[model samples]
Target chain A: MAYKCYKLESILTINNLTKKFGYLTAVKDLSFTIKKGNVYGILGPNGSGKSTTLGVVLNVVNKTSGDFHWFDGKISTHDALKKVGAIIERPNFYPYMSGYQNLKLVCKIKGVNYSKIEEKLKIVGLLERKDSKFKTFSLGMKQRLAIASALLNDPEILILDEPTNGLDPQGIHQIREIIKQIAAKGTTILLASHLLDEVEKVCTHVVVLRKGKKLYSGRVDEMISSNGFFELKCNNQEALVTLLERHNSFSKIKVENDLVTAFLTEPMRSDDFNKYLFEKGIILTHLIQRKESLEEQFLQLTDNQTNQI
Target chain B: MLRLLNIEYYKLKYNKASRVLIIIYFALLSLMSLFATIKFNIGPIKFHLAELGIFNFPYIWHFNTFVASLLKFFLLLVIVSMVANEYSNKTIKQNLIDGLSKKEFILSKFYCVIALSLISTFFVFVVSLILGFIYSSYTELTIVFSDLEFLIAFFVKLLGFFSFGLFLGMLIKRSAFAVAAMVVLFLIEIISYGIVCGINKGTELADRIYQFLPFKSLWNLIDEPGSRLSAVKEVAAQIGEDLSYDYSVRWYEIAIVLAWTALFIFLSYRLLKKRDL
Candidate 1:
């Protein structure tokens, strides 16, 4: 498939968006911007307003306050939505109708040509069962059909909420592959998920939300690579801890399960540390430098945010 | 508008409940006409016209209109199911997400109501025409087409009732509850009319005001046929005298039904706009 080249421009801008259900605030004053051709992930724990934010932007749920503009104010919400495809919360369709019929209905509503229906069904690996009723589809097949429906219009932007919520491992892999392929075609994809690994694997950019408040938003690589740490296990654990505690080169050294881990206080290489340990007569067995995983960063960020409150 | 109607037609085309309900409605409608053609005798008296008046020229319009209006329940059931299924299946939310405006969604349903009404009315018109030709004494076009106002009246009455059913479905958002609410509303309107009539006693103004109620206004569209058997006419006349209100179709009654239809459409639109899917 040929990829479309889109200009580097802001695709969506939301400012101080808040949604309140009576006394309970589902989404606080939230704001974010999505750029063209980037797979942006709204990452959060359950009930962190990930789905609500997507719903508000999609115009399915009315915002209580605040506003959002699509395409940097070039078009109204309705017009902007025409270029976007979305599936909010669940894959809802007419259960009694065949998948082909359901996609045809979507095409009718979106005013898109029905010619792409067969192609989309083939892309999702559901072309074989396209004639089957939605009620008879497995959960994985249902989710696949939903992606097909979203792709029916060849939308410039795709919004998905928990697209792989209840799928088995094989189902999850298929969905992830489909999403990557779509994103590879230069379509800006905005997806919400509570799965940390999914965001780390699929998202180029991420916004970490906790309890309807944004804790951090930036590139995923930048978030994970900011704090680099080293894990080391020596033949003598006591000597390794003492040596690291005395040296000013390393900070926050801690011993766990016969392994000493610490952050680099300054720019240094693992080779220098190994040489230092060899010089001190401390025979080394294992020394590895590792970047922080998104799960750890997410937990630390959310815990810190809670402690500040 | 045509596109929206086409979309609704596609949705209904595959719906089993809609298909079965429509089939049952037509079957029952045919049976009602069949019953109107049968003849029976009670000892020394005859009761064939009770079964034969529906086929007579000119009077056939009034007779068929009354019978068709009684089958409005089928239309109501179809409308309620169509509207309520959107909510239960969460398809309404999907429709909105697919870029359909709230107004378009409501208008699509109104189109469905109109289509259903028109189709059923056409059936009644065709059946009446066939029966009138086969059994009436006169063959002149004027004699067969006289009192055609009842046909128009019947169409409007179906539109009014079906639109009202759509409103109730929107309000209730549940098929079973909405249908039950329709029955309850009918009973409430009838009871309220009775209470008002009883309190006013012999006041003509109060009796006139009672005819303007939602369901009652629709009922007043086609007045009871006055050319029934003498015994039946006597009983109807006695009841009419006690109520102190005429069952004649009035111009304002048709106007009232049109107004109610507009009101229901407006309320349905308002409800869809204000409420989150």
Candidate 2:
């Protein structure tokens, strides 16, 4: 899908937000900005303040300190919320009511036209079962109905906290597809999930959180690209290590059990490294360039934070 | 406010418990009305409650208020369950997430309480009017409208009591617990009243202060009629004349009920605003 550039606008801005439950701090002084049309992901493990942050911003949980603005302060919090749809923690609805009835109630609360209910239900692939009671639905179906309710307002921004949680592979795939489709329609999304793979698959930008603190925030590709590494193996491992040590392009080299791993300091083709090593009489048996996965980066970041503390 | 009311109405209509509660309320109300209209003979005297000035134009107001007040427990149970179920189901959180302000959410329930009170009072008015026309001996318009204040008293008492129920529901956040707490609260108040009376040695000043208690204030809205039994008619007449305070709704009692209603609503709102859903 082609990206639409609507003049860069701040969709949501949270500053110095903190939430405390008695002496336990669920969300520390945290802040982030989400621009329009960006699929901003709050990536963290469970109890890492992802849901609490979403709750505070959505005005469902009162903040202990600081403030947040939605739609660039064009409206009050309640008024701004009308233009936003969200599902935090889990799919919560009137269980006794049918999917259609639940969505109707959402529309009523949102003060939106009911014409879009069917369209949203269709988008979530729940149109056929719209008449089924919420309690009768499978967890996946319940999650789909939640997404449908979130889309009923045709909101400008959607905030989903663990949207794909408790879903099977197929259910996760369907939810991700639905989210991508919604994003393509120019709806900014703020997703919170502990699943690093889900965040990597769906988010354009991510904010890594640990113990209620932000560890990193930037574009997903940049985060992975900056930490790219290469793994190499050869028949003469000792000679290969000595040769790579002489090269300034490779940094942080480590050799373990005939395997060599090192980060590339600058963008260089693997074929050039192979040729350079071949000139040194070291035959290149294997040369593999590996881009860091979000999971690895998340672990490293959180681990480093833990070590520092 | 209207939008909130509409939303609450939709919610209540879809809830089976609420529907059942309303049905039960009406059924019990009709049964009590029937019981009142039946005639019975005791010893040498043959007397029916309906004929003992109860269905008479002026006294119909008191009779209806007393009967309707007996059914207020059903409304209280419904309100308690409705409020507590929101917490149990986490639908209140969804409602807030769906763009409703905390104030709006509480106000919606408040609107439901008012609606219930008004509906209950309307039924009382209609039933009493019908029974009064059929059983009343007097035909004057003035007599028919003599004690209309009792209707206002009934409405106030229902609103006050239901708001208290709302408060209990919000405070407990569990249907069964809130209902149980309400029953316990009644026992506590009654027992406390007894203790206070004993301590004060049944002085008039103590009795006057006791009437101002929250539950006592609401119950005092409609005084029990004294002319029901022929045996006690003369003594009842003497007591009624001596007290002069026992038969009519007082301005202070209305103020007290209204005050308690406001306090309950305020506390419920504060609880919603301050708590994390």
Fnat per candidate, as a fraction, reads: 0.67, 0.80
- The per-candidate count of clashes, in order, stands at 1, 0
Q: List candidate 2 stretches off by more than 4 Å.
A: A1-6, A255-258, B41-47, B226-231, B235-245
Which stretches in model 1 have alpha-carbon errors above 4 Å?
Answer: A1-7, A72-74, A235-239, A246-251, B50-52, B202-206, B226-231, B234-248
Over the stretch A1-309, how does candidate 2's per-residue lDDT look in tens digits? 344465678889989889998999988889889998788899998999998898888888899998999977878888888899898777889888899998999999999898999999999999999898899999889888988898888888999989888899999888899888888887888889998887787789999998888888889888876547789988998888887888888787988887899887888887887788788898877789987788988898899899999
The CA lDDT at B176 in model 1 is 93
For all the predictions, what are the DockQ values?
A: 0.70, 0.79
Residue B70 error for model 2, in Å? 1.3
Index of the highest-TM-score prediction:
2
